[model samples]
Target: MLRTAAAAILGVTVLASASMAQDYRLNPIYQTISLRGGFTPDPYVINLQSGGNNDASRTLGGSCRGWVATAPDVRLHFQAGSLPLIISANSSTDTTLVVNGPDGRWYCNDDGGNGLNPSLRWNSPMSGQYDIWIGTYGSSRNANAQLHISELYSQ
Candidate 1:
């Protein structure tokens, strides 16, 4: 069940359902990332906070104007290759991960890593913008999550 949630992620053009989707962004907006092969640059971690509407009536950030809560989007340009991305929250019960890439495809992850952490590798990633959505499973709890992103490919 978990394996397919991300694989079947809706395309970027697809609007979220009635439950509402999140709009995330990095606290410090970094446009482009520099990377060399075989080098894991220091992971930039951001605190995840979500706000919006479940009815799809409210939009938070620019990327989520028609969507829901605040899900951080890191506008990045990397070398054309597979970029290994690691996104983790405080715990598995806290959050899920969804990414919208330059190709206009959505990549999602639900509890992929140990203790609900989500990780994915974008193969043949185009050099452009990316929408990184941190979705909270349990809305009753505060939106407390940490995102760790690393550029795994070098040009």
Candidate 2:
């Protein structure tokens, strides 16, 4: 009887250990934002809109009409930490959004002609601040854009 009880206790301990190990694995966290542009050059700053550290910064993806004569860009200011692995965007026009990281830049192209949902993945560097931009050569008047962010880390 004593040996049987010990064996049962050991089995229960092994099962509990396996369950704890699985529970400790990191899970991905996601955040989303919606942007609406006006007739005027209403550059939506993701950091400002999301309220700073709570959200990431954003820039024009590439060059717009007269504003931001260069590629549309979005600037982000981080808290000097690693970022998520996945970033996505959706718009009503063929647009490209680029994420400028501390190490390099990764881009997501949207060529749906009308608009599309696009996503890009990359390893973000640790930084105090970062910038991301989106834009197209043609004119996108009063366009709507959506941004999605996914972060994965072990607590």
lDDT top scorer: 1
As a whole number from 0 to 100, the lDDT of residue 119 in candidate 1 is: 54
C-alpha lDDT (0 to 100) for residue 117 of candidate 2: 38
lDDT of 1: 0.43
Question: What lDDT score belongs to each candidate, Candidate 1 first?
Answer: 0.43, 0.30
Judging by TM-score against the true structure, name the best candidate.
1
Query: What TM-score does model 2 achieve against the real structure?
Result: 0.38
Q: Write the per-residue lDDT of candidate 2 for residues 1-155, one digit (tens) a residue.
A: 01222321221100111111111122211222232211112222232111111111123222211111122234444432343343444455444444444444333234311234334443443543233444432443224455444343110
- lDDT tens readout by residue for model 1, 1-155: 12233442322223333122443334323233443323455455555553223312232221222222443434444444444444333443445555566665555555554455555454334566666655555453345556665543111
lDDT over C-alpha atoms for residue 97 of model 1: 56
